[model samples]
Target: MVRKIAAAAIAALFVPVVQAAGWEKLWTFEHGAGTSVAGQTSEILAFDSLNNELWVAGLKGVDILNAATGSFVQHIDTTAFGELNSVAIRNGVAAFAIAAPIKTDAGSVLTYDTTSRSFQQSYLVGALPDMVTFTADGRIMTANEGEPLARPGFATIEARGSISIIDTTKDSVTTLGFSGYDGTTGLGRIVSPGAKPSIDWEPEYIALSKDGQFAMVTLQEANAVAKIDLMSQQIVSVTSLGLKDHSLPGNELDTTDRDLPGNVSVAGNYRNAPVFGMYMPDTIASYASGGKTYYITANEGDSRNLEDFVNGEFNEEVRVGSSSYVLDPTAFPDAAALKATSNLGRLTVTTSGGDLDGDGDYDQIHVFGGRSFSILDENGNQVFDSGNQLEALLFADPALRALIDDGRSDNKGVEPEGVTVLELGDRTLAFIGFERTRQSVIAIYDVTNPTAATFVDFIVDADSLSPEGLSAYEFGGKYFLAVANEVSGTTSLFSITPVPEPETYAMLLAGLGLIGLAARRRRG
Candidate 1:
């Protein structure tokens, strides 16, 4: 049975007046001077357990902070390395991915010795290494998002994305290319005709298996997940996360925020459209349950229309005629409703997935990410998806609903972006970050039972806006959660204590009763 925490209880505990929940806000620290160039700020976070410090990937360089108290310790300037994208720490060594300074499709990783507090080495990696993680066997893995920089007159100069594996013992780098996984014959290819599995697949984030034997990377644009065998250093499979049927009862999504004139609603115009919703996950995490390995993904969708959107090649208003699969009158009772009520704005389907039915019109319409998170089995089959559940929880409370305007419903509602899982005593908790929500929030859920995740609490701080990174650690017998707020240039810290189980409560009650009986006997 799934246990539900009452919304009233959560709201009451969240208020400044009370501290009823097990989560406590520790401190929030803004970066020095709290100013940086746009698009450059606190991008990622990692904790160095050996040094008892937290490393943050910031605009100018990496910032080191005291893990116990959110105080600044030191700043490691990395300007010479180029813009820093992510940071990872393991075995007293820290590594960060830096974009290339030149026009080449290549990036580099800088390693630092935490104990010595000095730069150790630098290694060239693939283009735009977006995220980095260390395996249990001391191998550094980086997800290189091989996104090409637009050059004039060059239609396709982009290099294919890849995963770079570094052996710390030998200081050697091995890159696994995605061009081979082009969805031709392997599980990487989607059945959807529109899926251009070859060139468009960009590896966004990666999650290592619990035992560290395998790594699963998310292809955000391709709506797929790739499993890599850490030992053999080969991509075993790439499985497409098929679409979610929004017309289904539990999968309804608010397709439009435009309600009738007089009503300024938070729920927006809810729709049960008969269309497939893409599960374009941004950040993914893995856990083991029931002797099975499961992965959780924060389905934050993305699209590529840099050239086409500017060239007027496609517009939301430019209807693909009545033959377009999106114009199913059965889904939208009124024929004109598609144009009038759709919150999809101006977006076009990619030309990759072939046109099914051969009617000279696109047979399917693909939208952005699922706007939620999902738990998938080791095979990439979804065990449970929080379809519109996050939106429903936020909207149910007027105060939380008002935190972010309803306009976001049109484009990636709430936008679940980052996720981190930690073991709290007997329970395993998953913390999900909302990136686009005006006031970002960390939604905590008890994922002990992956299929039946139950909402427990939400951590909201003034500085939590556009949370791009999350790191959790245990120090001095206490667990701590760190949030890297990109927009605010701040790192928010919180302490978490797991809720006691029913058995614990019962034992406490029985002990109290026994004490009372002993006191009565002594009196007699």
Candidate 2:
């Protein structure tokens, strides 16, 4: 027991020191310090290589910063316009934001030309745009967070949510609208004013597949993620991550007596239901690995109880670390239909199977939570709902659980808003980022092995990293992680050099010795 205790102590010592050392402070950008139209930075940021710079968008106009020095480059004036909520840079031209005038029913999408250094074109968007992403083929996909339709005496009032897709080459933009909850089939669920009493349903963010054929969007106030098919323009998959049962008649706001799996049926007549069932999903990412496309979104929703329930201030604040969905692009009916209901599951990585490894293994998903970073399957089911065929759950240890739980606490690790899986040499590494709030961290995981994966400790910490939007790119034979910081109002470029593990180093030395001996033999 003494020996085991000593070993545990040694292991614990390695945790804080190593994790803290991994993150290196790259750069800091004070948005308003020296630049025009500067104030608090919004959580939305993006990279535009066409102009060879990083674009930071906030409540003010858009700021273009030098990617290398994190220096204040230039700011696009949107004062003639309105507050900027989203930005997209493509083909060397930048399109920042679209918004309505104060208390006015007017909004437009503004484009900034990198070559001319001028505002190029302005197109109309229906509602207030929150987030925007570039498609695989250079299309601009934007999402808004206002109610799309309104009706009195409706159980679930439709939140005016709009997604705008812009074809840059043709300068043509299409706007698609969706209401918060569609109860036509008696299948939709939502919160009542009496139950929630505080929250409102709205869309928050958007992301797209590599080919731009599919889009995964987050309805923040709605507390749901909808999968939209850009081709057919229909919502295909809708997943709710909040409580489902409702108390008041025609109300779907309710909670389970005990925490139940999100996909399972909730208890009937749940009380104290909130306005939206699911929490707010703040970020979204799309990646294609192992021949499957996955749409990952960040859930940063805060939970608050009704005023009458406690008569005091109490925040239940349930946040899903990070969740993802996978769907076949060909199976989607249209671009808009991608948000329709379908088979969707949480993104959990485990050796117990469920397609977590992309290997046809049945027992891959291990039951675990408190993960701010995750990768979803291209096939949808996080873990194949197989009977307990595997002997034991993979990575089913308390240490990992404790780490996740601690990391998920509001005061501990902030919301992991960005994630990307990149190919490092012959292996694959998952780059995860937690942002907003002051404490930001980036974690690197060696995910090469389908059954066994290694956490390379914390590769980046709060000191050097405050990642808002992260993308792993390869330039000049080196791996670079482009981090967009919301609070700092700057984006830094990080170089990820290959760090060989102890076993790999030992193997390399052994192979070299063997080669030297063979050469000596040949010489003799």
Deviation in Å, model 2, residue 94 alpha carbon = 1.6
Residue 178 of model 2: what lDDT? 47
Best by lDDT: 1
**What's model 2's lDDT at 75?**
73
For model 1, residues 153-192, the per-residue Cα lDDT tens digits are 5554656678899987898999988667554753543422
Q: Which stretches of candidate 1 lie over 4 Å from their true place?
A: 1-21, 32-40, 102-104, 153-156, 183-198, 262-266, 308-334, 342-355, 358-360, 502-524
How many residue pairs clash in each candidate at the backbone level?
Answer: 5, 50
Model 2: lowest-lDDT 10 consecutive positions: 515-524
The per-residue C-alpha lDDT of model 2 at residue 19 equals 14
Please report how far candidate 2 places residue 408 from its true position, in Å.
Answer: 8.9
Model 2, residue 181: what's the lDDT? 39
lDDT of 1 at 426: 64
